[model samples]
Target: MSKRTTLQIATYGIVCLAILLVPSFMDDAFILNKYARYLVLGILALALSLSWGYAGILNLGQAASFGLGSYCMAMALKLRTVPVHTGKTGLPDFMVWNNVETLPWFWEPFYSLTFAIFAGVAVPVAFAMLLGSFIFRGRVTGVYVAIITLAALVVVNLLIIDQQRYSGGFNGITDLAQLELFGLTFDAYSSSSYYLIAISLTVCLFFALAVTKSKAGLILQAIRDHEERVRYFGYDVARFKTFAFAVSAGIAGVAGMLYTIVMEFASPTFLDVQLSLSVVIWCAVGGRQSLLGAALGAIIVTGMQGALSESEIFLESWTLIMGFVFVMIVLFLPKGLAGAIESLVDRIIPEDHAVQVKSRAAASRRGVENEAGSP
Candidate 1:
């Protein structure tokens, strides 16, 4: 393999290794849970990178897909804990509190764990497909796409918050039981749960890497660079955009599902506009062009936020500080932190090796002994 490809492989391998060894270095359940949360958020940022950076489709409603996934798992877990004593898996407590005498037809499907798991992923992908059909088919691009997505996110958020009986309203779906697979219950704060998240992150990152290195990824980048030219070349630009949107939504949904399990609840905050914007910022600051960069950026940014917010002095000013940081990153490091690192590494470790010698004779001898001088 080429040196560049070998270096990339090594980078990914090292990241996976770090994820695997992190729990050993820090065993506290609270801290590990926080890191798991960061990883989950990283997956969401990576999702946006696929859609925005590669396909050139900026979606601001990504949280809508995330909420859908959270609700999918939340509904199932909620059902598990409901009173079956009535000879029926009764409605969630929030519903009954709102005088919901009978379970909703849609909620019935979630009673089955298999269906819930499937829907957690498929629901968001289907949603993206439907939205992309309308948006991309109509030739929406650039900031228009972002505006439309942001509008959709608001609509969905309002819908969930207003429908108190079915959705738990502003409180969202909560008090969920643990996820059961193969008769095993996964604990939110346990090591096993952290490992599950780490494995999932690794798998998702590798999958994204594979996608970005494929022929389709190249075409997607081309479309991002020149959509009109791509369309003129007879490629179904809309189809590819829709596919990227769907994949991004699916990954974001996975992040939502993981968040619900780790946090032990799903809230309306998952679908909030602020969160969607924050995710965009994370991608921007991490170098949205690279999947690994975006994911790593998410983790680092979230970690810093947490640490900074905990400080008594910075608690009130963290948001302002964050805004300044974003501006500076945009102005100076336009490619974001990962992109900057990549450039720096490239400079420090030149693609072509450089040889230096203590003396002119030594340098001349080395040059004569080199491949170019070999006979």
Candidate 2:
């Protein structure tokens, strides 16, 4: 095995170990749950890493996919806990308040927990596939892609808000009951929920790492460098872009579902442009090119945000502060904190393999610059 690959394996092993040990070191359930929220967001960053980092698709509507997943899970859980007469099938309270006697056809399927989980994942992937078919096949690239994604996010968010009676409107789906799987209940403030997020993050982190390290990942990177070149070589560039979009959306969908469980509610904010941009910022600050760094960026930035919010002096200005900090990171640490760590590792290791890793990374950086310059 190559030394570079070995180093990655070692790093991932350490991350897995740290995640598994979180419950042991943190006895406070509240803190654990908060960290779980950060991890859930980390998955969103990882999703962006797959599409934006590997595939060079700077999707700005990831919140739409994530919100769809959240609503799916929220709808099911909300259905179970909503007010219903003694002998009637349960329906969301808003429906009852609106004088609707029956469950909506669209929401009827979410009555089953199994279907909710399926829809939570499938809906986002399906949406991405449809959207990507149009975008990639039509040759949309770069900033146009970002604009289209942002527009889509606004559309989804407005749709959810407009149909307040059905979707809980601006308030979103709330009063969710505990998530029960295999006879075990996941309370929002409990260790079980925290572990659930941890395990999901671990599985997803490695899954993304594996994909990026595989032959498919290399080809995707090549497409990112020059889509026309790959097409000239007889490869279907659109298909691969669509696949990356679908996978990224699916992962974000899962994270959205997890967020609902951790927060015990799903709000329109999940689908907001602000959130979509925040995901991009997290990935950028962490090193969008590196999956581990992207995830770490989400966690570290979120942790600091949470900490700052608790402070009396910083509470009101945290958002502004974060925006400024993000700008600074973009200006100075354009490669992200992960890129810096990569450099540090190379220097400290004192191995010839480090030089090879740096050479390959510099080539990838050049590819990114080319993608940016592409029309």
Query: Each candidate: what lDDT?
Result: 0.87, 0.90
Model 2 segments beyond 4 Å from truth? 82-88, 349-375
lDDT of 2 by residue, 1-375 (tens): 777789988897799779879898788988989999999999999999999999999999999999999999999898778475523366677776767777779998988999999999999999999999999999898899999989988999999999987898888988888899999999989899988988888888888888888888888999987778888999888999998999999999999999999999999999999889989999999999899899989999999999999999999999899989999999999879998898898788766867778878978987897789777
Please give each candidate's TM-score: 0.90, 0.93
Q: What TM-score does prediction 1 earn?
A: 0.90
Measured over all alpha carbons after superposition, the RMSD of each candidate to the real structure, in angstroms, is: 9.2, 2.6
- For this target, which candidate reaches the highest TM-score against the unseen true structure? 2
Give lDDT: candidate 2, residue 219. 87
